[model samples]
Target chain A: MASNAGVAQSRALPGPVRFITSSIGAKVVMAVSGFVLVGFVLVHMIGNLQIFLGPEAINRYGNFLQGLGELLWVFRLGLLAALIAHVASAARLVILNQSARPINYSHNDYVQVKFAARTMPISGIVVLAFIIFHLAHFTGGKVQPELFHFQDELGQHDIYAMVTLGFQNWFISGFYIVANALLALHLSHGVSSMFQTLGVTAPAWRPLTHALGPVIGTIIFIGNVGIPLACSLGLVAIPAGAM
Target chain B: MHLTLHVWRQKSANDKGRLVQYEVDNISSDMSFLEMLDVFNESLIAKGEEPVAFDHDCREGICGACSLVINGIPHGPDEGTTVCQLHMRRFKDGDTIYIEPWRAKAFPVIRDLIVDRTAFDRIQQAGGFITINTGGAPDANALPIAKTEADLAMDAAACIGCGACVAACPNASAMLFVGAKVSQFLHLPQGHPERARRVKAMVEQMDAEGFGNCTNHYECMAACPKEIDVRVIAELNLEFMKAKISGRE
Candidate 1:
């Protein structure tokens, strides 16, 4: 133990990777990747909200995105990388945390710790499964190909009709509601903790930053769940012949 | 008042430990928790049994020597108070109390209700102090510091190096302790010269000690005997990022 005394610890690796494997450095990675994913969720929610306007509005929005060609793939690939990094970092931290306490306490108690904070890993896993299922159901056109075929007289894909039709099924609508709710629950803790990890935690900024997660999470939940709820309730009628 | 105690009894560092229950009667409410333990141990000594062993010093709470997870909460029920300061009145007349040692990979149990905390010392040695010496005590107002910054530094300085934060944290993270030590220096010019190198070395040593990472649960702040704010951890994070980004060793 005395062999390394008075010497600065040797760091073999040079760039960001060296630090990222450290305790706090991994948290920074989680925060940065979380930022990317949260932004994507917000924009995705807002974009999908266009469905409330009409089929033309949302269908045109889809056409515009599909029209991006290679650029869209760039965005998709970038987002996928962020997802992979976020999950990998979270898994690493989870294992480290579990091993930190090899012995169990006879009695466990919590003071001022939030429920959302405690369930982060479970909520994260559920949300990840929802994302994969969502992508397969929507983008890959694999879940329900019949609904995926909805199109307008312009012969372009009608995403509004496609989505509304997909949610018309009771089982699918229920799953969407449950998944979106857990996503909000996940965000309610993730958003606030993200700021702390990024070091945006000045005391003066506590009120605003602490509330950011639950507030933004609720808004996203309302926006996303409203679409599916409206579809199941027949509030958003199927476009004339597209369904 | 009579009390039932479930105390963890470990023979040595390698021995597996468990809660052994005992009953004590005629306890006074005015006795401090440690005093009550003293009474309990005396009874066991009279009965020719191995008495319980616990760590304590100064009994007034500043030393950070006493550690006990009383009824699952570190340092007992009182907020911003250490175990030595916990009085018997806090519990009911016939309450059952569970006492355990600080449980963490970095803090191995040395005996019953006592764990080795030299990992903290090693982290401190890694770089928890100012290397520069001012030669002697300086005159008041020699180097004026802003009131707010001074208060903030003192707030971080109030940490007594208690392991309650780690004991209370679900992850057993030592972020609050390290943050307090690092942050006390961060707000002053005395800490400026070696700031980058200090945070890096201390954090590296902390990780090497196998302490867990902070997840901002704020459990440490609640369990802290000093009630050290969680913002120091944010400051530590910021400083660490700066050091790494600036290519400091």
Candidate 2:
């Protein structure tokens, strides 16, 4: 009996493994990866905001990142891993959640469910598509190489020219604006939800916890959208020397 | 008062149910929701038709047997009140109420508003207990539990296993129910010995039962008859993390 029990135990998932495999486990993975991605977005926005400081500052920033070289690739790989984990876990969770309720309630109502929470998957997909387009436009230089390929006066990759040229196009600027709006919605739900999933929510901190999502989401939205808006409106122009 | 109710009706577990409309006339405003159902059932019996089946015991709302989703809100529009305690006065005359069973893949419809909530019992059986010595009752003060902890335990203990939290959840998650059971024990000294093991066993059982995960929508808390806090879910997650980290399955 003892041997049989031991064999069965070995066949079954161990405690930690089982914990990560469960629904809550998937949620925890999404939450943690979301935190990493949120941090990246904030830093990326701060870096991009250097456009206000003129061509040299922005080009210097780009050069600094390029200077990291192989280490930069390592950072890129880490961000990629976080994105993949977040997406995969969320996809699995969505499937499991849909399967849990085979029948639909004809008159389902939303009492406390927010618009942001209801549209998380939709916003997440939009943000994902935007991320791919963004990479193609800037990182890969494959979208419009003619405009994307330029060098600043200091012989650095002309990020300022690329950003201005890209956003000056009405369609591209509009897409960026819309995508950032959706990202705001996604973050509004996702930020506070991460705290809840990680078990950091306490009754004493309810107000602060609830406000975290919307606050961060608004800041990101304003910061990101401000760039494209300023670019299209000619408020921030590519410096003459840099072009 | 006259009211129209679109109550869900199914003959058995395998039967595909649909909404069957019934009209109840001359219902007093003071009549409880279940009492109104009793009147309708009487009329059905007189007409030689099958009475609508539903679960209800201790009609005072403590039994947790009453499970009904009225107009998309579990237990009716009022917060913190069970279906058994809901009165007809809350609705206007000539109102049409949409009534349905607690819809979940795990909790199948047995008949009309009755769902097989035995899944909850199975989850409870997995770990919702403490090993006790078979002897005379110990003194209440012997455990030396802090008043705050005792209060929190009682708050969680108020869960009646009615499955309202699951019904109210968009994902059909039983997290609140499982969290309540785990929290109730976690706060008490008697639950210390089996703390890690209990959380692991119960969480494993919950996953095996195929309930959806919580996404912090807070609908379950709003729809809960006992008003169980969603924070308990955080507690459950914390306990599960500690158990896994401690390597104590």
Candidate 3:
């Protein structure tokens, strides 16, 4: 028995390396990367809310971000890495889950699983698509050249004009609203699930962790949609000379 | 009660299975689900037809031998009860019921309604024991255990090894079963000697068995005939993390 134990130990992979290849390890990666992305979304939403402060404040905020130059690229690259890890882990889990049930049941019942949990893969894909479209529209200036490349009087990129004009278009605003709603649905399940996967929620605090998902998701949804809705309704408009 | 059952019929593990319908009349409402199957089997014998094969033992819930996904829900529509304990009264007269085997890649169908659950036995064999010196039985009072801890351990130990959790889970994960076994030992003082090794081995075995990962769907808890809580899965995660971290040192 002692010899066998030694043999097993010698044959086993190193702890950290084995963990990355294990099922739980993949889930942990998903949870951690999900946290990073969630943080980025919240910060981005808060920064966008600065548009309510008018052209100077919002454009200056954009200029400040661009001012960082290489530092900004580093941040973007970090975010890109997180996004790739999150999506890769998610896709792998999906494939494994599908293979787990080789035979399909004619009738299957779900008791405690919610709609958001059931449609996670779909909602995740939708959010990914929205992210790509958003970057192309705002950052790349490829989607709408006329509105995206405008400059304010001070010669900074007119972020305020771009945002207000984009939201004023019903199609852009509607798409933003719909995509944000889907993101909320995805986050509602993802957030609580991450807590469970990380094993941070003890039995005593399980209820709180479960409720955290919807609460955070709702806050983000409202914060993001508020900007677009306000812009479309003429509540927040571009400054007189900023365009 | 007269009922129609669309039972899954398979010749062997290598053969294709199909839902074959059968009619059983005059089933007593007081008859347990297995008893109903017995009556149907007797009718098949009388007709010289091949009777539907299923796994059952003790005709009681404790054995965890009887497994059936009745009407899409594991162990029929009844909660916290196995098929052997589920009475026919739970069904309406002339109702059509769908019955299928526990479906998972780790649990392949051996025959009708019987999957090779030896995968579970292999997982248990990996680390589900303590390597204590052989001796006489210890006194009941030899190890003093707190009531709360003992109760929680017993609760987790109550798992009967039924694969309903796998059938009910969309991901077909076995975290609940593995969690229950790990928690049963983790909460006990006697189980501490090999805690890290046990958790690591069992989890590795579980992964090697081709079971899917848990995504916190909570369906396993709902479908469990023994009502094992998913909180045990959290405990399993904790134990695994501890093992991985401590093993590095």
Question: Best by lDDT, which number?
Answer: 1
Model 1 score (lDDT): 0.91
Q: Each candidate: fraction of true contacts kept?
A: 0.71, 0.64, 0.62
Model 1, span A44-111: residue lDDT tens: 99999998998888999999999999999999999999999999999999999999999979898889
B37-133: candidate 1 lDDT, tens digit per residue: 9999999999999999999999999999999999889999999999999999999998999999999998999999999999899999989998776
Winner by DockQ: 1
What TM-score, computed on C-alpha atoms, does each candidate reach? 0.97, 0.96, 0.95
- For every model shown, the clashing-pair count is 0, 0, 0
Q: What fraction of native interface contacts is shared by candidate 3?
A: 0.62
Give the poorly placed runs of model 3, Cα more than 4 Å off: A1-15, A239-243
Interface root-mean-square deviation for each candidate? Answer: 3.0, 5.0, 4.8
As for DockQ, the candidate ahead, 1 or 3, is: 1
Which 10-residue window of candidate 1 chain A scores lowest in summed lDDT?
A: A1-10
- In model 1, the runs with Cα more than 4 Å from the true position are A1-10, A239-243, B134-139
lDDT of 2 at A169: 90
CAPRI-style docking class of model 1 based on DockQ:
medium
Ranking by TM-score: 1, 2, 3
